[model samples]
Target: MSANTPMLITFVIYIAAMVLIGLFAYLRTRNFSDYILGGRSLGSFVTALSAGASDMSGWLLMGLPGAIYLSGLSESWIAIGLIAGAWLNWLFVAGRLRVQTEHNGNALTLPDYFTTRFEDNSRILRVFSALVILVFFTIYCASGIVAGARLFESTFGMSYETALWAGAAATIAYTFVGGFLAVSWTDTVQATLMIFALILTPIVVMLATGGVDTTFLAIEANDPTNFDMLKGASFVGVISLLAWGLGYFGQPHILARFMAADSVKSIPAARRISMTWMILCLGGAVAVGFFGIAYFSANPDVAGAVSENPERVFIELAKLLFNPWIAGVLLSAILAAVMSTLSCQLLVCSSALTEDFYKAFLRKGASQRELVWVGRGMVLLISVIAIIVARDPESKVLGLVSYAWAGFGAAFGPVVIFSLVWKGMTRNGALAGMLVGAVTVVLWKQYVGLGLYEIIPGFIFASLAILIFSKIGSGPTAGMLERFDAAEKEYQDAHL
Candidate 1:
C-alpha cells in the first residue's frame, strides 16, 4: 500500500462528514436570513469557536509557523498584536455590534447595518461598503485558497494546478448548500481538531528534543537570534506588526459571528471562551515552529521537505515523528483550518452580492427561496473569481493574507469604531474613512518605501479622515440617535 493511503482516507472521511453537515443544515434553513446569517441563532459555545476558527484560518497553522521557522522569535510580535487587538474587539465591538445591528432594522450584514445606522438616504454608503467587502474579501479568500493549495501540493503530491481546484472543492460544496449554520457548526468541530493538533504536535517535538532547556539550547546553537525578540526589529516595524489587531474591527466574517449570536448577553462568555482558545492555539503554533528548529537541527537527514518550504514544518514534522494514522488526523487539522475560513468568507461574499446588490436593487420583492438560491449562486461566482486570483503558484500565504488584512483593517476599522461610538459621526464621515483607509493601504503597499506595515498608516489616515469629515458633515438624525442610544443601553445592560 502507498504511504499516502491513510492520510487520503482521513481527508476523504473528513470531507464527507462536513458535507453531511451542510446537508443537515440545509434541511433547517428556511429563508435568506437563515442562509446567510443562521437566522441569528448561534449559542455562546458555537459563537466562540466559530469566530476563532474563521478568524485564524490556515494562517495560524501554516503562515505563522512558517514565519517563526524562517525568522525566529522576532516574528511573534505579530501574534502579540493579534491577541491584544482581538481582546479589545471582543470587549468593545462584539456586543455593541450585536445589539446595534439588531436594532437597525435587523440588518443581516455590515452594509445593511451601516445604511440604517447613519440613515444614508442615497444608499451610497451601502453600495460602497459592499463593494469594499467584495474587493478585499476576494483577496482574503485567495489567501485561503493558496494555503489550501500548498497543503494539497505538499501532501498529496498533486500538481499545483490540480491542487488548486481539488483543494477548493469540498469547502465550496458545503458552503454552497448549507450557508452560515453549516460553516459555524463545522467550525466548532474544526476548532476542536485544530487545538488538539497544535497542542499535541508541540509537546511531542519538545519531548523529542529532550526538554524545554535542551530545545532552547539547540535553537540557540542554530541561531542565537532565534531567542532575541528585538533582533533587527525597529520601532516602526514593531508597531506595524502589532497593528494586526486593528483589522479585527473591520473583518466581516468575524463580525458576522457577533451578529449571529442568539443575543447580546452571549458576548461576555463567548469572549472568554474565544480568547482562551486563541491564546493557547497561537502559543502552540509558535512552539511548533520554534521547537521544529531544534528537531530539524538534530535530524537534518529527514528535513528535506521542510527545508525546501518552511511552511511545511508542521506537515513534515507530523508525518515524520508520528505514526501514519496519527499524522493523518493532525494533518486534517490544517484542512479544517482552511475550510473553516474559506467557507465563511464565501458565505459573506455571497451575502454581499445577494443582500447588498441583488435584493437591494434588482429584486426588492424577491421571495425568500429565490434569495437563498441567489446566495448559493453568488457563492459559486465568488469561488471562481477567487480561484482565478489564486492561480499564481508562487503566492505566499502570509504575504497575501497581510495585504488583504491591511485593506480591510484600514478601510473599515475606523468607520466601524466611529459609527458605533461617536454620536456625531455622519454618513459622509463613514464614506471618507472607508475610502481613505482603503486607498492608503493600496498606494502604500504599491509605492511606499517605508518598512512599516501598511495597516498602521492606513488606520491612522482613515481615523483622521473620519474625524475631519464628521466635523464638517451633519450630525446623526434624531431617529439615528435614538436607535444608537437605545442599543448602547441594551448592550450595557447585557454586560452588567
Candidate 2:
C-alpha cells in the first residue's frame, strides 16, 4: 500500500528464511562438536560458499567498493592482496590444518589446535590464543554491526540505534539457535544471493552509465589520478595494501570452514570453487565503486553522491537503477553479506568462550548439552558488546575491519604458519610469536606513527620470534615432529 512496503516485505522474508534454517540446524545438532563445527560434515559446496561468505563479510560489497569510489586503482591493491592470501591459505594451510587438527587430538578450535600441536600441557597456548580470538573477533563483529546499521539507517530513514539492532537481529537469532551448521547452510544461501546481487547490480549500473568507455572517460575527466595504479601510492602504502592477505592464515572463521569440510580430500574442489567466486565477486564490487564515480559525476544529485558515508554507493545504485520490488531484493543482498559474516563471527566467538575458556578451565567435566547452551548464551553476550562498540554512528566500516584484520594477521599469522610447517618450533616459540605479533600490532598502531600498516612489522617480528625462540629454547618433542611430518606427508599424498 505504501512506497516502503515492498522493501519491508522482502526483509521480513529474508530474515525468516535465516531463522528457519537455524531451527533446522538446531534439530541436527547432537553434541558440543556438532554445535561448534557441524560434526565436520560439510560438503564441498557448503564449505566453499560458507568460507567465502565468512571471509569477505560486508567489506567485499561495501568497504572495497567505497575504497575504489573514494580513491581509484590504489584501492584495488587490497583486493589483490586478499585474493593472493586466500589462495595461499587454501593451498598450504587448508588441507594441512584439516588433517593435522583431527590428528592432533581432534582440536575443535585454533587455540585447542595450538596446545595439542605443540604438546603444551600448561594450557598457556590455548588460553592466550583464545584471548586473541575473543578480543579481535569482538571488534570484527562490531564492524559488521556498523555496516548493518548504516544499511538500515539509509534504507528506512531510521535512527542509528534502531538500525543497529535491526541490522544485528537476524544474525543473532540464527547463530544463537543453529550454531555452526545453521551458520554454514545460511551462508550458502547468502553467498548465492551476494553473487547474484554483485553480478546484477554492476550490469545495471554499467548500462545506466552508457558502457565501459563512457564510464572510463567520466572517471578520467572527473579526476585523472583515479586511473593511475600507483597514484599517490608510496612503497609502504603499497606494501600495507598487499599485506592484507596475510590475515587469512590467522582468521578463525575462515579456517573453521576448512576444519569442517567432510574430508581433507574435499578441499581441492572447495578451494577451486571459492577462488573463482571470490575473484568474480571482488571484481564486480570494484566495478560498482569505479562506475559510481562515473555515474555520480554525470548526475551529482543522486542520493549517494553526496552522502556522508561513501559506503552507501552500492545501495544507492540499487535504489536508483531498479524498481521498488527489485531494489528491495537487491538491497537485501547487502543485508545478506552483513548477516552471513556477522553470524560466523558471533559463532566463532561463542566457540572460543565455551570450548577454550569454560570447558578447559571453568568446567572441565561439563556435559555436551551444557556446553552447547553456554555457547548459545555467549552468542547473546558478545552480540550485545558488539552493538555497544558499534554505537558510534560516525564509525567507518572499512576502518574498523582494517584494524581487526591487521590485529589477527599480526597476532596469529606467524604462529599458525610456523606451527604447521616447522617441526622444530617449540611451545615456547609459539607463545613468543603470538605475544610479539599481538603486542607489536598494538604498539605499532599507537607509538610508531609510521605510514606503514601494522601487520607488516607485526608479522615479521612474530616470525622472527618463533624462529629465534625455537633455536634458543628446547625444540618440539620427537612426537610433535613426527605428527608434523605425518600431516605434511598425508597432505602431499592426498593431492597426488
Candidate 3:
C-alpha cells in the first residue's frame, strides 16, 4: 500500500460526504425554485460563505500561492482590489438586484433577470445572454476542473485524467442532486474547512522552519526580490493581474447570490462576513506560498524532491509537517477549495441553460419536473466537456480562470452595472455592450500581442461599448425609464 493511504481514504470519505449532502439536498427539492435559489430562504451567513468560497476557489490555493512564491508582496494588491470590489458589490448591487428580481418575477438565472428587467419579451436578449453564459461558463468550469485535477494528482499520485474525472463527477453528482441549497450549504462547510487549512498550515510550516522572523530573514537572504513588494520579479505583472477584480460586476455565479439573497437588509451582513473571510483566507494562502519557500530553503532536499511541480507547494508541506491523520484532513481542505467552486459553477451554468434558454425559448410549455431534469442533464453535459478540456493538463488554472473571468466581466459587468444605475441604458445598448465586451475579450486574448493581460483591454472595450452604444442606440423606452427611476428611488430611500 502507498504510504499516503490514510490521506487517500480521508479524501474518499470527504467526497462521499459531499455527494451525500447533495443527495440530501436533492431529496428536499420539490420544485424549480427549491433547486435554483433554495426558495430564496438563505440567511446572510450561508449566502456570504457560499459566495466567498466559490469566488476564491483554486485561485486562492494555487494561483495566489504561486504568485506569492514567484512574485512577492505585490500579489496582495489583487486581494486588496478584490476585497474592495466585493464590498462595493454587496453594498450597491446586492439589495437592488434581489428586490428587483423578485419584483420582476424572475426566480431563476442571470439571463432571466436581464430579460425580465429590460422587458425583453422578444427573447433576443435572453438567447444572446444565455449563449454568453454557456460559452464563458464552459471555460470557467474547465478552470475549476483543472484545479481539481491538480489537487488529486498532487496528493494521491493519481493520473491527471483519473483525478479530473473523479473531481468532476463528485461535484456534478452533488450539484445535480442538491441544486442551489446543496451548493450553498456545502460551500459553507467547505469555506470553514478552507479557513482552517489556510490558518493551520502556515502556522505549522512557520514553526517547523524555526519561526516567522527566521523564515522571513531566510527568504530575504536567499532572494531579496521575495521581500520587495514592487521590485519583485513579477510585481507589476501580478498587480495588473490582480486588478482583474473589476470583473466582479458581471459574474453570474457571484451576482446570482445577490439576486437570491433573502433581502437587501441581509446583504450588508453577508458583505461583512464574506469580505472578512476573503481577507483572512486569501492572506493566509499568500503566506503559505511565501513560507513554503522558506521551509523548502531550510531543507533543500525537500525542495528538490518536488522540484518539477511548484504548484504542489501545499501538498508537499502537508506530508513534511503533519501526521497522516492531520494531512488527510488538510488534503480534504484542498479538495474543498476545488470542489466548492466547481459545484457552484456547474449549478450556475445549468440554471442559465434550463431557466434562461430551455424554458424561455426551446420548451416554453415544459413543466417544472421536466426543467429539473433538463438542468440535471445540462450539468452532466458540462461536466463531461470540462473534463475533456482538462485532459490536456497544460492549461494552468490561473490562466484559464483569468480568460473566463475577463470574458464574463467584459460581457456582462458593464451592462449589469449600467442597467441598474443608468435609466438611459437601452436594450440596444445592453446588447451592443454584451457583444462588444465578449468579442473584445476573445480577440484580445487571441490576436493581441500587446503583452498586457487581456482583461485590461477587455474592460476598456466593454466600458466603451456601454457608453457609446447607450448614447448612439435608441434610448430606453419611456416605460422602462420610469421603472428604472422608481427602482433607483426605492434603492436610495431604503439605504437612506
Best candidate per lDDT, number? 1
| Pairs in steric clash, model 3 | none
Q: How would you encode candidate 2's per-residue C-alpha lDDT over 350-433 as one tens digit per residue?
A: 999999999999999999999999999999999999898899856554355566788888788888887778788999889999
Query: Which 10-residue window of candidate 1 scores lowest in summed lDDT?
Result: 393-402
- State residue 402's C-alpha deviation in candidate 2, in Å: 3.3
Provide the overall lDDT of each model, using Cα atoms, as 2-decimal numbers: 0.92, 0.89, 0.81
Q: What are the per-residue Cα lDDT tens digits for candidate 3 across 1-496?
A: 6668988888888889888899899888888888888888789999999998888787787767776776667666778778777877787778888776775555477778777677776878788888888877787788888888878776777898788887787888899889988998899999999999999999999999889799899888778887776664364476565657777888888887787777677888898999889888988888898998888878988786445666677878888899887899987887898888888888888988889878876898988889888988999988888887778867564355557877888888888887877777777778888888888888888887365667667777777887887788466777776666676666677677
lDDT tens digits, residues 156-191, model 1? 999988999988999999999999999999999999
Q: In candidate 3, what residue range of length 10 has the lowest lDDT sum?
A: 232-241
Question: What ranges in model 1 sit over 4 Å off?
Answer: 395-401
Per-candidate count of clashing residue pairs (backbone under 3 Å): 0, 0, 0
Model 2 Cα shift for residue 17 (angstroms):
0.5
Candidate 2 wrong stretches, greater than 4 Å: 303-307, 394-401
TM-score of 1: 0.98
